[model samples]
Target: MKTKAVRLYGKSDLRLEEFELPEITDDEMLAKVVSDSLCMSSYKAALQGGDHKRVPDNVAENPVIIGHEFCGEVVKAGKNVAHLAKPGDKFTVQPAMFYKGSLEAPGYSYPFYGGDATYIIIPSEAFETDCFLKYDGEAFYHGSLAEPMSCIAGGAHVNYHTKFGSYVHEMGIKEGGKMALLAGVGPMGLGTIDYALHASRKPALLVVTDIDPVRLARAEALFTIEEAKKQGVELHYVNTAEKDEAYVMELSGGTGYDDVYVMAPVKPVVEMGDNILGMDGCLNFFAGPTNTEFKAEFNFYDVHYAATHVCSNSGGNTQDMREVLKMMGEGRLEPSVMITHVGGLNCVPEVTLKLHDIPGGKKLIYTQIDMPLTAIDDFAELGKTDAMFAELAKIVERSNGLWSAEAERYLLKNAKPIG
Candidate 1:
């Protein structure tokens, strides 16, 4: 099969090209990628190229495709995996296939098994590690979003607290305890809020803080206080630009929070999370810093006396991905809240290379289409000239400015096909 993909040849060298895919072995499968969500990790991989741990050292000579968070349909299932999947089966992958402790993963390490292509050969390691998951959701974008949402789910799951006497560690965030998300208005932070509000285990009082009023306002509008109240969660959106740590403490009733999630890699944000932890509190540093020397201060005094601790996670395991997919399929979680931009496969090179400069949430790409990276917020303005944007504007406006299954269907049906 022939595939169009964005490949990384070296540091800051990403190219969009078409190439023939080798025939799938009996241990492998064939898939047609439909939707992929751009991640900051992909940008980092492009920046470091072969230097990135997951990227191969010979990447300059053997370029690898550059995307991991993706979803698609099975075009052909090899005999060995036929029992697990079949033709036309919708699927998403857990790209972190830590097969035998190797750093190699799908997007950064594999030439024929990344998300940025129209077609790919599923490697045998994915099946061996049970990372090849079947997604039954109606929208391909939801399947694409499952991987990211699982990271949030994994973050929550990995948090642990200890009792005063026993040596046992209690896993997960403290249920019915106070929780805070610092600098939490970005895409991953938004997903964290969604999971916190709707997941089986939840905090009684949920506080989200951000420096940007525009982002905080948008977050409030999307995950309304009214909706949180129905779920028995007291939700608060605090603009830290005007308020101080004292103001945040007032909301927690003078006592510190039981769970504090640091959403940004900023030093101040990490220190703020550390300063507000109650006894036996678990602080989850959810952001992944690009710098190897990234450091933040924590009160060791509290750690020694109050039993406070810290933990971090880069991506979710297979079980976390399954939970996210289950929640999405049950209509309990709306991962679409993370998406801010949409484009086609043709735009993947530029978008992936300069992703950090482009401000917004997730940038979703449809592999078979040919369109520039366009913001959903700009749909109405673009609608004045294009009839397709006009209809999309109406569809999203009715859904309160969020992307939807309806919009994906419309775009795939109307947008120009990738040539």
Candidate 2:
């Protein structure tokens, strides 16, 4: 079969190309690429086209694929495959296969297959040990978010600060405890909320916060806060715009949110560290900042004095994928619930190019056309490099301002400080 995939040839360059299928090696299973999730990293690949380690050229010297989230049935299994693979056995793939001899993490990700195209060759590690669960659902998006979910799972294990002591926690969540889905409005952010809500047994107060009035409104409508509360998940939408620090403090009644996830873009988090997160809050930096140049400072004294610990993770590992899939199977983690917009391969470049300063949850991509995904159009391309960049800069600035306004408001509404 022919497959279309993305390759990072050089810095700031990503191109889609078609390829012929290769023979599957022993101890591997072939899977069709069904649903791939878009991440900030894809944007990085679009701009910095080359892999500094794998491909020395700024442009891709050879073809490489960019999708990681996906699931499918076994199309073909290699002769020496140890895991019993039969056709029509639907399964969810755990994107990365960390093996002894093959890991290129520091400079670039090792050849971990992704779920963005016609097919893929997976090592036995993901399935031999039962990491990739069987997917029986008719629709595809359910299991495709394994990598992202795994990251969240890992984040849960992070060591953040708390009022009493270190914010360290185990996946051994209590039956009925007070937990909050802090900054739980964006698409990825929403996924975290859905996971926490459904994954819990007795349920907790499912409070949500977002700076955007529109997104908060959308989330409320999508999943009635009250309805979830009936299932033991209380929903509270906090607009960081109105209440300020007092509002969050009031919500806790006295103590702070048990679990605070930093899901919004970067700045809100710096603001969160300074404003909310009571004496003993577990802050999960759910969304990793994209631009390194962008910096926001928080208090060192609050961290040391309050005994609050902060934790962050890049992506999910294998254990998380299994947990997310099991939750999906039983109807806990519903990724389909967070999808706001959907488009085919041809739409990726435009989606990425747009200054997403507008309020929304998540935008999903199903395909990538064969060619470079260019965000800028031809008219802007022909102009002088500096001038065109300046114009593009304008679009980004306008969007950023709108985003900031909404975010500041969100923090105030949900993140409360302790006495």
Candidate 3:
């Protein structure tokens, strides 16, 4: 069967092309992709291309599909895994697959099976590795977001405890304790905020710091202090560049944060988060750095005397995706807040190329639809000019500028089919 996909050939080379999909064997499964979210990791992959660790060596001659966070419907399942995932099953798979002790993952390593295509082959390894999750959500986009949301959940799951004269480690943040998200108003940071707010063991005081006052202002608007207070959270948004050290110290009641997350990979931000650690404080290096030799300063005195420690999580596993999915299913967490724009598969190349330059949250690509990428906030303005977009704006506006199941239905109902 022929399918359209965005494939990467090498550095700075991404193409939207049509190719024949190979038949699935008994150990594989075929799925029709619905939604895929563009991620920063994909942006980096595009720049690195063949040099990327997970990119297969033959990518230049045989291009590979390039999206990871996605959800789809099972079209055909091989007999080996048909019992686990059958036809018509709506599902999302954890892209962080380590098959047979290899670092290969979907998007970066697989040739025909990635999120940016209309159909994908789920290798037997995916099923054997326990990366597939059955999704019964209101919208397919939510299933795609479960992957990134799970990454945030993974950070919160990292935990540490010290035994008598020894050390111990655990997953998860300090429950119901003080926490700080530094440089935390960006896309991933926003996801962290959503997860932090609705986490089972919520924080008593959640302080979010950003260098940009504008970004901090936007964060305040999204995660309103009133809402946080109602949820038993004392939330604070601070422009760390402007706010003095004394002010932040005062907010933490003289001690420092119990858990400090450095959302940016910058050196200064990492040091800043380290500096504000309270006794037995845990600093989470949540953001990944692209540079091979990225360095940050830490006070060894505090690490030894005050028991300050550090932890880092690259990505979430299958269990983390399951947790985030359940939270979304229960309505305790809303993953849609991360989505700011939506588009069709054809626009994947453009969107992926200028992803960082774009000033919005998650950009969702609908593989089956041929619509241009439209920002949710722009729908209202577009409604004033274009009738069709205006119709879309109404559904989105009714949901308070947030994408909802009704909005998804409306778009699918009105979208022009791929020709």
Per-model root-mean-square deviation over C-alphas: 0.9, 11.9, 1.5
Q: What tens-digit string does per-residue lDDT give for candidate 1 at 102-211?
A: 97888899999999999999999999999999998899999999999999999999999898999999999999999999999999999999999999999999999999
Error of 2 at 102 (Å): 6.1
Q: What lDDT does the true structure give each of the candidates? A: 0.94, 0.56, 0.87
> Largest lDDT belongs to which candidate?
1
TM-scores of all predicted structures: 0.98, 0.74, 0.96
Q: What is the lDDT of residue 311 in candidate 2?
A: 64
Please write out the lDDT profile of model 3 over residues 125-203, one tens digit for every residue.
Answer: 8888889888888799999999999899888887564544665564567777899999898878888888888878788
Worst 10 residues of 2 by lDDT: 401-410
Instruction: Point out the higher-scoring one by lDDT: 2 or 3.
Output: 3
Clashes of each: 0, 36, 5
RMSD (CA, Å), candidate 3 to true, equals 1.5
What ranges in model 2 sit over 4 Å off?
A: 51-59, 101-112, 123-133, 157-177, 201-203, 349-359, 367-419
lDDT at residue 73 of model 3 (Cα atoms): 97
Predicted structure 2, TM vs. truth: 0.74
> Candidate 2's residue-wise lDDT over 2-121, tens digit each?
666554445544555567766667877777654555665555544554533323342344445555566566788778763566776777755444445443221124232555555666
